[model samples]
Target: MSENQYAISEYHDADEINARLKELVGQPLHPIRRDKMEEYLRYFDTKCSRSKAMTDEAKTIIPGGVQHNLAFNYPFPLAVRKVEGAYMWDEDDNKYIDFLQAGGPTVLGSNYPPVRDKVLELVRECGPVTGLFHEFELKLAQKVQEHMPGIEMFRMLGSGTESVMAAIRAARTFTGKKKVIKVGGAYHGWSDQMVYGLHIPGTRTFEAKGIPGSASRHTQEFYPNDLGQLHRRLIANRLRGGTAAVIVEPLGPESGTRPVPFDFNQQVRELCDRFGALLIFDEVVTGFRVGMGGAQGYFGVTPDLTIFGKCITGGYPMAGGVGGRKEVMQRFAPGIGGTGERAYIGGTLSANPMSCAAGYYAIEEMERTNAAILAGRAGDRLTRGLKEIIERLGLPFVAYNQGSIVHLETGAVMLLDVRNPVKLLKELKPRKHMMEEMGAAYMSQGVVTLAGSRIYTSMADTDEIIDEALNRFETVLSSVEGIA
Candidate 1:
């Protein structure tokens, strides 16, 4: 495949990025200046009073005043009232450049008119769901297959969590093996078994509260980019009823915050083949965003099963599915005949006409406009500008991109691993708080980012938009302590 076909212009060296991340975490916290943070917080108080009032009232009914995890912004989440290409307006009408992109689904940008219009037409014609067959379901699946031929068949589900659950169940049923291995710190969604290693590697079950120990009994994890550790675990699992599947986020954990080497996926594929295990690529964040073919296409490696997440519908609801070779995918066939033979999974609104139409049209538009490559160019510009700002201000920060999925590591909170349990435990809270403050600072300057660290650029992010965002980032980064 040509380089232009995928979002990643080049693959980053995992070792080099890890070394920089280590240096960042080793240093004392370089938080936003206290005065600057107070000022930014005041922006939330004065400028966002309406948002405060609404979220405060919501807190009485909703836990943490927000429903989704991404909505948990520091100093309380902003109530978004409007979202368009590359920008969103909070309830208070405060305009900001959108880098979050609805948590990496809106590659064509938020509320993209083409996709929205198509969805509206579908909803008007047939309604959202009939709890029955929809033609668009076949159309959407065919569209996905057109781009990703490895997915000989597709099964739609309600959410990424549900899709992952179905995938694991299918793996176990197909292979008749109990154990499944995953890369540590990679989120395959909030499914019980996959929740063993949440944010930090080696911290098994640390965040798996309220769940029974048996839930993750067969789940295992190796450190990110650590193939030797994974090999040993696979070897160990062989003695214990053999391995079922090896799942990974092809772009590495947290969408390349902990990046993998160029050949990582191919190596993992080889290991899976050698161990008689199925390879599952969790392309929830990477699927269409990386390219129409996904990370597997970008890396020139194919997996037995591929998981598609929110982007399947171009940020539309009911956007999750599992696709793979015909033999394995047939395991998800809906019927009543095979009790133990089939991997049963169902969602009432899984392949709603609205979602199917939206996904099909959105993907068609993506291919028509070459959105992924355009978005990647924007990411390259943004990362380059952020790096220049960091260097000029003499700050201990890191900036890089895997195409449109850009990562700016100002706090390095996610970099902390269980390798040094004492350091991780001691620094976790402070580092986390620092990230929260940084996010708030950026928001105050009219930039919305993911945890103040990761930024997802879209095709709507033109040169002018990117340059303006860089100015906002420069203002936020320059306010860090010791920056002249």
Candidate 2:
């Protein structure tokens, strides 16, 4: 198959799009009673007062009071003023031991002196961006290739979404196939095609607004742990022609959404091979943060293509690219009018010098200090401590990790009553709310977390910080239990 032969066909039908929208928007109201909504709102107001005020100010300018949807909560999101080694101070002059770390970018901690120095030095020399090429991009690409051997070739983008968009485009072009399959509940990015089944159960359509249904008509989604479901979908798609690629987070459910069973990823890899479809690992969150080589390296299951972001730039704006077998990547060569035909994958700021410098320095520091190994050890310590404390309190929670990505899930809430969607959504919402509340409480006490998600450890997260966080977690759990 050639790239030019597999061009995408347009299907624009306003009536069909409108009808689908009506069907989705006309779904019945949430089953929760007024009392439940009132309770949740009250709790949100009480615990997130500072966030609320900031959100109120933000609403005037930014939509939904935040630029990114994930940045918004029920009340609002806090505005961070400044960040240091392992801490952040909010606009309200409150300090927190920040674990959010800019959604997995700051693997080395906020404002590390080494990275900052490198960035400053580069900026002083030739400024931030130039239309022409720079040496920093080559240095960063070499660093990434050193760690992830699967990347025989590389490109760069502004965010994970752009990289993923290009990967899907390239896969379809390479395979001469139209359809793509993704794991349900796993978020690859916000691009139109990859947005299907995001936040499933309640919203099975597009996750965010403005993403047309026709744009995702060729995409299919299947649950993470169900190989049978995957097999069925692949078979169905193959009967119609064949799927181009099956992109997924190797550690499913968006990395931290759930602990991936050891066999799940291996099974998916096997299925992709069986179906003759390329398997892509969207390692946006797990890349370089989980280990030196990301999830594929940790799991020992190589994918045809891998997408990276976040930690690649060390909390900077630079994201990453699509990398795969030379044969597949060669489809983008200039001899074939590659830039125009193969996959229109270009960005003005792609692989710019400033971001390249940040990424190169960050990865070098991680290698120099063996940051991933140390982070894994720190994760083990924190999880063990939390498990012991939760057991003593008889709290319904479990703490686990995949390398440095530490997570705690409420066993009592997540395991209760899985039969009804309404009940399940209701239960999950409160549990999520409580988790956020606990995070806020921890912040008030000078310990910050990744806001109910997994925590990314840094070399700066010393033993004292870990011990203090555990102690505060115990205290916060007791308080929450009393309130309940």
Candidate 3:
């Protein structure tokens, strides 16, 4: 497919976006007015009494009353009883526009009937797993390879974290090197080495609690979009044991929360080639969301290896994999098939029959409906509408999208980095709180978002749905303290 055929029709200028983000963080917090905030919070206490009570009871057993960090809403997490198309109903039967989209995996929309029916049929026929090979495994692999030609060989895993671990291990084994470098603030996974620089650049090990120092000694990070800094690290690692791989989220870290220039990936590929290090694309979010061919296709930059995540199974469980050129992927061969060296990765439920079938059917469905492009249209509409709202309200918030992955920076919380330690220390708490409040305000207005900052639009979001969402968003944005 051509570049325009993919989801992202236009790539935002990364430098300009970053400059606007800097200006946003430099300003005072423009949170919802106190009266408006209290009124919104009342929605949780009164209207959502059932959800609040249920979460409170679960808090006695579950840590933070939620298993996933994304569920950590400001007032409290809501118990979702139903999801379909572009909406969700909480336990209290309150409806919300589902902008979260199950954290960007449901591009085809939540609980899509076609995919779900196929899964149910497969379950009734042969159960979920069989500890052996199935035809859908080959079908899923072939489907992925058909879309992402760079992924000549593929290995299915349990989750995105496992896929990252496997990719790093394969890179090291193939190159006979020990070090790996990643863009600071990019979230590849929670593995020890990958956790070195979490959230903010230069804050290495800040969130590496309980992980020993030795766990990440060989891992390093450089500032986002700084090719010079990356080149320096590549040269430095040369004097040591040499770099194994340089991994990145093709759009930017945290799903383009920090957007990179259009040519950033191509430059990184060149540096990797010059330094004899493998380039890995952590496409956990961008793989299918950007297009059937992924960000590599969008940017026309091929990586030695690419990681896959939830969208592989269309939001089903056990959705992760690693794919790339045949030579490097050979390192993941199991049993006695390998020549001599092996990466040695295993999972009891990896490539289960249900997951494979779900992935195969999902990809087929995505291709048939051109879901990525449709979802991207929804994202474009939503983003344009959000920008209009922010502009009309005279707010400092920023909004942008890379296809279906949309970011609305109300507090610019994720933009903070250790590059400005004093500023980080002074504002991190209030900024984070403001982000949470923004989420609460949106929820009260019957819109669900990912932490009040990120949103995932799906093929199900029609122009009508997007316009309605924009109206709700305006309700919250207009409530900002300084808004006219």
Candidate 3 local lDDT, residue 204:
89
RMSD of each: 0.9, 9.8, 1.1
- lDDT by residue (1-484, candidate 1, tens digit) is 6798998888777889889988998899999889889998989989998899999999999999999898899999999999999999999999999999999999999999988988988898899999888999999999999999999999888888898899889998899998999888888888889888888899899999988989999999999989999999999999999999999999899898898888899999999999999999999999999999999888889899999987899999988999998988888888657675798898778888888888899999999999999999999999999989999999889999999999999889889989999999899999999999999999999999998899999999999999999999988888899987
Q: Which residue runs does candidate 3 get wrong by more than 4 Å? A: 336-339
The candidates, ranked best first by TM-score, are 1, 3, 2
* lDDT tens digits by residue: candidate 3, 1-484: 3856799978888899999999999999998999999999999989998898999999999999989989999899999999999999999999999999888888899999999999999999999999889999999999999988899999999999999999999999999999999999889889999888888888889999999999999999999888999999999999998999999999999999999998899999999999999999999999899999999988999999999997999999998999998999999989746567799899999999999999899888999999999999999999999999888888889999998999999899889878788999999999999999999999999999999999999999999999999999998999999876
Cα displacement (angstroms), candidate 1, residue 176, comes to 0.6
Evaluate all candidate structures by whole-model CA lDDT and list the values in order: 0.91, 0.69, 0.93
lDDT of 1 at 228: 99
TM-score of 2: 0.84
Largest lDDT belongs to which candidate? Answer: 3
TM-score attained by model 1: 0.99
Score residue 126 of candidate 1 by CA lDDT: 90
Off by over 4 Å in 2: 1-55, 73-75, 201-203, 206-208, 333-341, 411-419, 425-432, 482-484
